[model samples]
Target: MAVNQTQSSLVIPDNNASVSGNPGPWTEPTFTLAAKVRVGVTCCFFLIASCSNVAVLCSISGKRCKSHLRVLILSLSVADLLVTFLVMPLDSLWNVMVQWYAGELSCKVLNFGKLFAMYSAALVLVVISLDRHWAILYPLSFTSAGQRNRIMLWTAWITSLLLASPQLFLFRLRTAPGVNFTQCATHGSFTQHWQETAYNMFTFCTLFVTPLVVMIVCYTRILWEIGKQMKHKNELARSKNDLISKARLKTLKMTLVIVASFMVCWTPYYLLGLWYWFQPEMINQTPEYLNHSLFLFGLLHTCTDPLVYGLYTPSFKEDLRSWIRRISSILSRRAKNSKQLAISELNIKDLTSMEGPTSTAVTMQSVF
Candidate 1:
């Protein structure tokens, strides 16, 4: 999902890790500008995304943050956080070293994590959109925030893990006859050709296309519902008031922003993958820079959730501000206390100095 060779739609390293082994002359991979840029971008994103996703997790896990949308966001942030921590650093390493020195087990685990996080994030988005669709269009049927069952969240994680389990088997450290180091990759063979193609199609449709379709449909229906409700003069006051609530509108906007960011960040990687599936030759022809750039774009989505939600949702914004203020207060208090202690110490020193030998002698004599 990020920039891992295993996650790439091409399933083939554009240059370094050859699919069919050593074709003829084998030369060591040299570091290039694309590698440098990919490493730098990945490192930057790893820091930003890891911190933001963690902050979102902290913000939403609080008692005050109870809501269906917040719960969904909590789940989504978990997935993004996993991607940021588990997938990003290794992907960045692969981008730079252009070799997989890690053993077969490491390869399987890393690839599984990448696929699991990606699928889980996408599926969670679909679930959120569906929840919104149900809540917005049929207010009567939707459960209250406290009443919402966590079954769907559990199901998303389990389902994503089940779907991505193939990576454990398909991924292994592969080394060409003449190559010194092994790379984590699937075998590009006649037997495995169909398997790779089918898996790629499944991942693309499940993780990208289907979720996108679900989001679009849900959002469209939601808008239609809102518009229809607004037009009905005889609509129940409660319904009208619900629609007009600032919190509701903010939630909707936040949802749209999250969906839009996901689409923007992921679409290119999926589209490029789709193209590569049809035109395997293009894999060789596609510029390495473009491939790295697309992966970077996809990775950017991992960091954007908090920003999107914070900007559009007042509650999250307020929570963030409160968290910041609390931290500032603690720091300020510590500084003030330290300053007071310093002043007290200085005053004590001045008093002792002023007392001089006379005071010291009197005090010692009295004590004796």
Candidate 2:
């Protein structure tokens, strides 16, 4: 979901220069600064970790790496990275130091990036859940990996572009009356309202609610499948242990991890949005403290994405281990070389002592 910076009920004045209409108080600068700093640091950490994992996963070139789910995971990483690198940094800066100081171009770019990333990520998650559900419930009838991957890729691109169209078309920079800086927001008009409503409904339904329902249902069915497998194993006396069974177990674990993380990360943001939707006037009447609190909670999703990848991807852990080993090896070699050089100097001093005619002679030779 796109983050809304303005209070819901606060209306902008019609005249650019007049401050006649009293719309509620603006958010406090200090509180906003703290919120931005906290969010920025969190997003930076997630971005670094997630991008590192993505690089590692993409570098793998074997049969195990060529799964449909892995492709979806990569797509998710890219989408989250885009949000972290392209959108959140500028958003934090705008929130803390310069409320929309970067100008019209920045405003447009940030808006588009935020909405596009969010929509794409949501779409990928939904696709992943559906794929898992089909594979587990109807193994024989499941779609080919190539077909699913192609369709999801197309959907991600098209949905993101479509979702972001509103920002590109409706967003503009307008001077807030009596305020020195310009604000980037939806233009206030009937057309803008209908357009934003349509965008919100699309996002709320397709991106948030639909995916959430699908994940819950899919995971529930998966649990049922696992139960059936376990029961069959218990009852059968001559069942063969098979490679397929092992692979299925591994896939189930990974799916559980992904679904759990996605739900935990995204639930707060969607709940907050729903809350705001139900109580439109709360934004205007609520104190800055409450609004800022909601904003921070909403941003937690961006901060938790990398942790999700690390929890699910075995390749990510292996790559991290390899990185640590390389660093350790480098340090060990440097230390060994330093020790060898120190021993060589000592040996040279010992030889000079043995060849000296007197102690003073030996000390002088060593000094030279």
**C-alpha RMSD of each candidate structure in angstroms:** 4.5, 5.9
Stretches of model 1 off by over 4 angstroms after superposition: 1-27, 144-149, 188-192, 233-240, 243-246, 332-368
Q: Write the per-residue lDDT of candidate 1 for residues 1-368, one digit (tens) a residue.
A: 22234334223333223433444344555557877888898999999998888887877777665466667888888888888887788777776667777787988888888888888888888888777776676667655533453677778889999988887887777665665756677664225445566766877777788889999999999888878867995755666565545456567778888899999998887788777765555766778788778888988998888788667656667887898999999999999999997886676557568898667666555545
- The digit string of per-residue lDDT tens for model 2 on 130-200 reads 77777777766544865877697788779778867667765678665565646676645234434445666
Q: Please give the TM-score that candidate 2 achieves against the real structure.
A: 0.75
Which one is best on lDDT? 1
Q: What is the TM-score of each candidate against the true structure?
A: 0.82, 0.75
Count of clashing residue pairs in every prediction: 0, 0
List the lowest-lDDT window of 10 residues for candidate 1. 1-10
